[model samples]
Structure formats: C-alpha cells, structure tokens
Target: MEKAGLAEFNVKIVESCLVPPCLPSPRATLYLSNLDNQPLVRTDSNVLLVYEVCENVLPDPAKTIREALSKVLVYYYPVAGRLRKKEDGKLQVECTGEGVLFVEAMVDKSLSVLGDLDQLKPSFKQLLFRFPSNTAIEDVHPMVIQVNHFACGGFVVAVSFQHMVCDGRGVGQFLKGLGEMARGHVKPSIEPVWYRELLKPKNIPVHDLELTKEKIESTSDSWIPLIYKESTQMSLTLDFETVKYVKDGIMLECLDNCTTFEIVAALVWQARTRVLEIPHTQNVSIFFAVDVRRSFNPPLPNGYYGNGVVAIGAQAIAHDVINQPLSYLVNMIKKTKMSLTNEYLISIIDTDQFLLDIYSNQANIILSDWRWLGFNEVDFGSGSPVNICPIYWNENGPNISNGFVFVHSPKRKCDAFKVIVWMPPQEFNLLEIEIEAITNKYVVNGSNY
Candidate 1:
C-alpha cells in the first residue's frame, strides 16, 4: 500500500539530463513573426503541471519521460535548437539540435504538505520546477523540463519554453505529443506541421491604416508598465455561476450579446483604468492575441507548429473607457475580434512596426485565455495533472510582464475560472470589490451563494 500526491515541500535534486532531439533535424533558421518580436513577448514561457503518481508505481519516471521527450523532439526539432539573430536583425531558431534541458528531483514533502493546489504561489514553482536563470531568449534554454518526486509518491512536471518559438496552443500540441509518446504511442494524434512560410510578410510591406498609426502613437511615458509604484498581483477565483450572472447581465444591455471573455475583459479593463486614475484625456488600449490560424485566406495547417497569432489592439480614451458602461467596453472588445480578418493579419504582419510601437510603449492590459489549451491532456502515464499553473505564478518571479492570464480553476465541487492579474495592490483590492459587486448585480440564478 502507498500514499498518493505529496506529503511535504522539502525538496532536493536527484537526476538531470541535457536531453537533445533523438534525431538531428535539418539545420535551418525558423523565422519569427511581428507579434513574436514584440519587446513584451520576449520572455521565457514557463509552466508547472503537477500530478500524483502512486508510490513506486513507476521506476525512473524522469529517465522514461526524458526518452519520450527525445523522440517527441525528433519531430518537433526546432524546440531543441537555439534562438539567434540573423544578419537581417530578425530572430530565428538555428536548428543545430543542441538539445533541451531536463532535470529530476526528489522532495521530502508531499502534496498534502503543500496545502491547497488552487493557492499555488511562487514558492511552489521554485521548489518543483527548474526556472531559467534569466528570461533572455539567448540566455535561457529555449526549452527545459523538470520532474520532481515527492515523498508521498506524487510528482510535478514543469516545462519552460522560449516565447519566440510558439504560442500557447502550439506548445499544448507538443506537450500532448510528449505525453502520448510517454504512454507508448509511437506517433502523435496530430502530426507536427511547421509552415513558417505561410506568415511571411508581403513584398513592400503595407502600413496604410490610420487607425494602426493612431493606436501606435497613443502610448506615452505616463503609462509605462515598467514604472511601478508598489505593484502587486492577485489570484482570483470565479465560479461558473458568477460567470453566468455576468453574461446574463451583459445580455440585458446588449440584447442577447457579448461573450464571457468580453464581459470579464471589459470589467478588468475598466477596473484597471479606474484604479490607475489616469487623466480622462489620455488614451488607453487593451491587447489580445488573435489566433489567425483559421482566419488566414488559406488557413494554416491543422497542426501548424509556429506562432500563428496576431496582436489586436482595442483603444479608447481614458474618459470613454472609464465612464462608458460595461457594455460599451464589451462591444469594443467584440469589434476588435471581428476586425481580425485575413487582410488585417497580413497588414499587421507586413508593417508590424506600428503594432510593435504600440506594444512597446503602452502600459495596457494584455489578457491571454489559457482555459482552452487542454492542459489536462498532458498525461504522462501516472495520471492527468491535478493542477496546471501558468507562466509567472506570482509577482516576485522572473519576467513579471504587464499582462494577465485566465486558467481553469481546480475547484472541486464545481466549475470555476481563475484570473491571474498583475497590477498595483490598491487596484487589485478595488478590482476585487468591483468584481464581487459586478457579479452580485445580476445574480438572478443563485450566483451570490
């Protein structure tokens, strides 16, 4: 008989490896997209997926997983290469197959000692994962994985990737392949596809849009996310009922319109604006990464394995955003999504400098939804992960970018959403109050309980 999960947090290293791709991939340079080269997006993407394996049920799980990774890399070979700048000053992966980093550690603790999974913080990451010394693309390994074994028989698997390589959905595909191989599947359910040529900028790049230029020029030094006056992070939990209430409330105002993302994002955008108390005349914007894989004229391959997303900007005056009703904000968000046409994507790709300008100077809120990434499917034989913590769990960690992430909460009794928000402490408190108040406003179906 054996206990499951973790028992405590005391940890120590046991094994490690520099696991390279099993087969040498062709030496080539994989290009980066305009969205990829943004100063804001140039951070190492790190994540922790925790699972509870029965005690001694599997021997040398680390080595076994490493072997699976090697095979997986043979197909997803670019991950094993290094990110370098070419003579043209563009970023690309030099497919030298230098190998990725994998580490195995043993912890004197168990999941029980770690306390609630939903309350995961930076300490949990520092203990269970192998964090890169820095977030620099050249400094940190583009890819790394850490396997930790707890005394109570549970283990945690963490993976860090260079953001320049792929987006979240792309990474999920790779992880799924790794899991399938670990489970004895020779090939992945969806074979790897790298169509980098599909997103190449058009000849004589077009920068004709006035809106793009206006939005790009809106950002001033006043709102630089880098300048902080006691910034903080808040990990919030929202149940399905509360979310429904929000949706319903917005529907009333918009005549059966608005999405959960729209409502929630509108609230967050407005709340942050309110908290910041910026001048009414000043301009503000919200940024979202639109998945253009399907929006392209000739859609990308089903399993296209590159950064196939474009950054969309939603802008308005501070006064308008703050004074306008939530529906107004929601409508703006909806419009932004509706505007990501094939042509718009190419326009951004061609003269992405304008978009890049906005991204570099604006201190706007960047929200990326991770609920649909299917992280639970990253099973490596023992069992599906009990919890999956997204990039930068807390404020003190590396690359605390001025962005927020939405993830599925591990709420036992019901479905819920967890929004990881990075903002000033005062704003977070205010946003918390606003969030509760907003949910309570239209709780027609027992949402307040």
Candidate 2:
C-alpha cells in the first residue's frame, strides 16, 4: 500500500483513486503525527463493529469546491485511544487494533437547492434527521464537510459533527480552516493543538476529602442511565430585529439584567411548560451549551479542538421559570452565566470523576442558539446556506426535542435573522403563538417586525 503524503494532500484526487478494495479500510490504524503516530482515541469495545461511510460526489466545479473532503479529516488527529482508570487508580489509553472501519461516499442526484429557501429549510432539516442512529462518541468524527450542487446553478455546503467533539464555535474554526486551505494557504487559521493531559483526573488526598462517603456512594449510584424519546421540527426564520426589540421591551419593563438569549430562552421555556403543563413544582432544568474554549486552564491554545465546551444549566421549580417575571428569569439566566467560570467547569469535571460519570438525565427542553454562533459562515465554495437547522434524537425514553435558532443575514435588505425552532408539533404550535405575539408587539411599536 502506498502511503499518502500528510499535510500536503489534495482531497478530490485522493477520493477518486482511494476506492474500496484498494484503499485502507476506515477501521485502519488511527495515528497522531506527533505522538509516535499512535492511536489516541478508540471506539467502545462493547458495540458491534460496522464500517463508517463518507460520501463524495463531484459538484459543479466552483472556484472553491474540493473534489473530496478527505483533506479536512486528515488534518485532525484521530482518537487513538482514551485514558481510563485501572482498579489501582491509574490512567491508560486502551488501544484496540484498527483498520479503515468505514469509508463510503455516494453522489446523489438530489440538488442542494432542489427547493426555494423556505422549502430548502425543511430539506436541510431532513438531512439532519438522517443522522445515523448507530453513532458512537468515537465514531462521531471531529468534522464532516459536505458540498452539493443545487439545481439553481449554485451549490450548498453542510457540515455535520458530533457535539461532543466540537462546539459551534469550533465548527466555525474548522470551516475557516477549510476555507483557508481551499484558498491555497499553507497553514490553518490556528495551528491544531491536542492536550488530553488537561482532561486527566486530579490527585486528591483521601484525608482532605470534602465529599462524604454517602455523597460519593449516591453519586456513584446516580449513574443509572435512562433513555429518552427525541424529535426534531423546524419553523421559518423569526424576525430577528423584532425578537430583539421584544426581548428588550420585556427586559426594560421587568428591570432585569438578563441577556437576549436568556430572555428568549426563558420565554420559550415558559411556553414549553405551559404546553406540557407539567406540575409547577416539578424540578425542571433548562441547559444551553456554552463554548468553553477560553474557560480552560492556561486557556485552550488557539486551535485546540476536541470538545471545548460545558453545558450551562439553570434548574428550578418549573413554576419559577414559567411564572417568574421576565426580569427574574433574566437574573436566573445571568446567574447561570456566572457558573461558566473555570472553577465551576473543573469542579463539574472533577466531581464527575473526569467524565467517567456521564449524565443521561434528559431535560424537558434544550435550547441551542446558533444565531450568534456563526453557522452562516459555513461556506463550502458555494454561497452561504439558504437555511440551516438541527436534527432530533431519542436518547433513552424521555421525550427530548432539540431547538436550534439561526440568523439569516442575506445580501438583501429584507433578510431577517430567521429562526427555525425544532420541537414536537404541539410544542411548536404553542411556541409559534408566543413568537407571533412578540413579532406583533414589535409591529405595534413601529419596529421592524
């Protein structure tokens, strides 16, 4: 087998020649260039082994469209293995033998812009809905960049990634890197950095333990994982300016110090509670994924990749989040922001025993704000996306619906920050009413509704 040149390889030509039966299997050995070319991340040994697929089809040549996405994948070091604790409390990366586990690319006749922007919104949503069910944390690659031609003589580029691998901001960094590479740049926007050492559990003296034995036992027993039902739906873009004005109005009236995200999220949470009408006293938690690249010790180096994020959550009696004044809701969200500190993040990580304990608990609602996160910059040679949204998933048994809202700043004046909220049909309807009221209020105030 001929070894491909690292760092200076072209993806398109590689894809055409690297067909199956000749190319290395997707399960082939995973190696990092700086670390003895050893595998650092490995799949869970419990799952059934399956081939991973990467679809590649030629799009009408745009100045920037690459033939294959292999170049992008090659840049990131594959997880050779993960360090796990032994019975003696030592960490080790358990390496499993590897070959190309999976790699397959198909060219579909489906045009990227087979429908109008509004129509394309759902089409994109459907693509997200098609995420493979068997996705494991390890199988979920760090990045997947896709570019497809549209029937309208244009093209669309979409990137799907595992949330555990990178946050939305990290995705922006990856896209920027691809853009630089397509432009013939020798180096990425930021040099890639991998410091798994930062994730190592700290050594705590047994005599100085603050956690009680019962607390430790309870924490250990809390690992009982529960499954949840997940679904994804989409709404047309919301009036960004109007929504901002509405949020501002609510903030001013309530005299609260909450951000727009908090206000909007609170409104959605309240509406969801109304629709679900769960007992006001029931414990309800609302969590928003926060990018923590800057929250790490010595702060993650500019291009540090894998999963630089922490979930910032606000839990309270369902009634408080629902019936509380907008100001109060804003304060709750503000307080949540304070929890993004390094101590809190490390504490959470440490207390959870270095991620050994995974939280399978499902929140009634999870709101992801993509508007300010820069999803619009995901240009793959073609123009920006006409619409973008997230897919749904059922984790254990509890019904979990994911909502992603993005802003659409097109070349036109009428271009508003379009919001597409994905939720169960009934929940969406209730949210629609609240959104409409806010928009209507903006119109009454003579603002851009």
The TM-score values for the models, in the order shown, are 0.88, 0.66
lDDT minimum window of 10 residues, candidate 1: 1-10
- Cα deviation of 286, candidate 1, in Å: 1.4
lDDT of 2 at 68: 24
lDDT of 1 at 411: 32
- Model 2 ranges off by over 4 Å: 1-74, 79-132, 135-145, 204-232, 253-257, 353-363, 392-415, 438-449
Best by lDDT: 1
Candidate lDDT values, in order? 0.72, 0.45
Question: What are the per-residue Cα lDDT tens digits for candidate 1 across 1-449?
Answer: 23333333556777666788777778887877766665545666767777766542556678778999999999988888888877776688788888888888887767665543444444566553444354455655677888888786777787877777877888889999998999899888898887676677775454445446665655543655444534444567777777787787788788857777888888788877776777787778888776778898888888886777666768888899888878888889998899877777777677655355443443577878887776767878876677676645433553343577877775352487777766566667887887676667668545543
Give the alpha carbon lDDT tens digit for every residue of 113-161 in model 2: 2322332222233222122557644443333434433333434444445
Could you tell me the C-alpha RMSD of candidate 1 in Å? 4.0
In Å, residue 227's CA in model 1 sits off its true spot by: 3.6
